[model samples]
Target: MSTYIRQIKKNVWKWKNENGIFSVKKYPTVEQAEKIRLIHKELEYMEKPFILPIIESTQEDFIIQPWYKGDHTVSYRFKEDRKAVHLLLSQIHDTNKLVDWEDSNLFYSFNLISKWQNRKWKMNEISFFIESHIGWEQTKFLLLCGDIALRNMKPFNMEKRTLLHGDVVHHNFLSDSSDYKIIDFDLAVIGPREMENILWMHRVLPEINYDIRLLIHEFPHLEKVVRRYKEAMMYPNELYREWLYAYSLPKERKQKFIEQLIPYTNKALTEWPNLCYTLSKL
Candidate 1:
């Protein structure tokens, strides 16, 4: 039987053939393509097998790589896989190799918070979807978190900022047998170590449906810092990025993934503040 790759989403695919499992994704620019190449190199240097090897595509359409055959990105078995996830992250985070990119990520995260007042989309129905579920107060707190993170989250001089995976959600974690590997680098950026950890623990972890208390207990030393960072993450910049990406697509191609987006927003708002309150007392 002839094996074929199936589309997982626009410009993304998963399939297995006679050779092995693989995935392909479109790169918006050559710079992105180069960045992925650089990331793969760094991962190899780290002696980590978590990153999937890139398969060069002869055409200019998409970047191809071996698909992790073990499992897809999911939230279950977090406890069992958490250690491997952290280990892989530690290796990647420890690298000093710099990819060519500016440090506008934090700015971008909170930029909308300040400008939302003047944003034409403030009254747009999409905004209503977010506000209705999260409430104005929760919204205000999130923006506040953005403000604080923008102003206060700084790089540690001891451990210089380095390249980060950018998107470290639970699903990026692939478990092959007993080991775990990470996939996706299109959103990679260079930032402070603390910021990377903060972003993962605050934003990505929650999105993956992790229990905030368990996270706090797992890393008690980082509790205060994590909470502070979580507060600053009231507005996840990634959501805006995703919406912009989707909006740029043809109407027929846009699947209104916002259906999932709003609930995630609500989940963050509903849980974060309560977690903050709990953390404060502890």
Candidate 2:
């Protein structure tokens, strides 16, 4: 173990001489870390590379295998390696990694509400944001995607619950000549396979030129579910607010960002009805 630490950012440190990378996480319990480690070993044995190759960690701190010099942006280039990306995600979702893992995807469900409440405990201000921006009326309709899927679509029709990387934001994916890999598993857990794909569809699709039907063909059972989730995505405002609110900023600056997002969110909402209908016919 390297005692020398080079600070890369807040709470994130790099081992000297490119040994590895480490970060201090705020949640996912010590037990979850252990499970992640177990999954890494399993992936290695199965000839799949779990990018989050955990080197070692305690309750709050964990290390990852060092990444090579390459493009780490999570973007449309993923389309270039679509088969590899789908293989990686499918292998992950299909495997039974651990038992009693928490659900990480926020699909429409009572389970998601429970997880939201738990998350709210940590980010108390999010509750205020939710109340002021996404009130009960919105929350009720938020999971319509989940409801439609569970009611109409069959379950995963697999042996084990799908494990999710949770946060599929593009930056979490790294690319090189060989393939793409995922990082940042602090929010990793078991959940619906569609939920993860849905995130990729919204977060990665619009930025790229690839046809989303490629993803649909890969997970045909999840076609409608994926469409529903995609339709529900409230752009810039809802998405940006969620992403930006986490940063430690001055109160005034944060409020400014929120206010600026209102028009964009309203525009998205205004277009959603027509968009929703279009997606429904798909």
- Give me the candidate number with maximum lDDT: 1
User: What is the lDDT for 148 in model 1?
Assistant: 48
Candidate 2 worst ten-residue window by lDDT: 104-113
Query: Which is the leading candidate under TM-score?
Result: 1
lDDT of each: 0.60, 0.52
Candidate 1 residue lDDT tens string, 125-238: 344444554577765655554444446543344335666777767778777666777888777766566656665665445634546667767667667665555444433455
Candidate 1 has its poorest 10 consecutive residues by lDDT at 104-113
What candidate 1 gets wrong by more than 4 Å, as runs, is: 1-5, 15-18, 71-73, 97-159, 204-213, 227-270, 279-282
On residues 165-273, what C-alpha lDDT tens digit does candidate 2 reach at each position?
7776666667776667766665676666765665556654444322455556755765777555543332222343352463356776867766655554455444545
| lDDT value for model 1 | 0.60
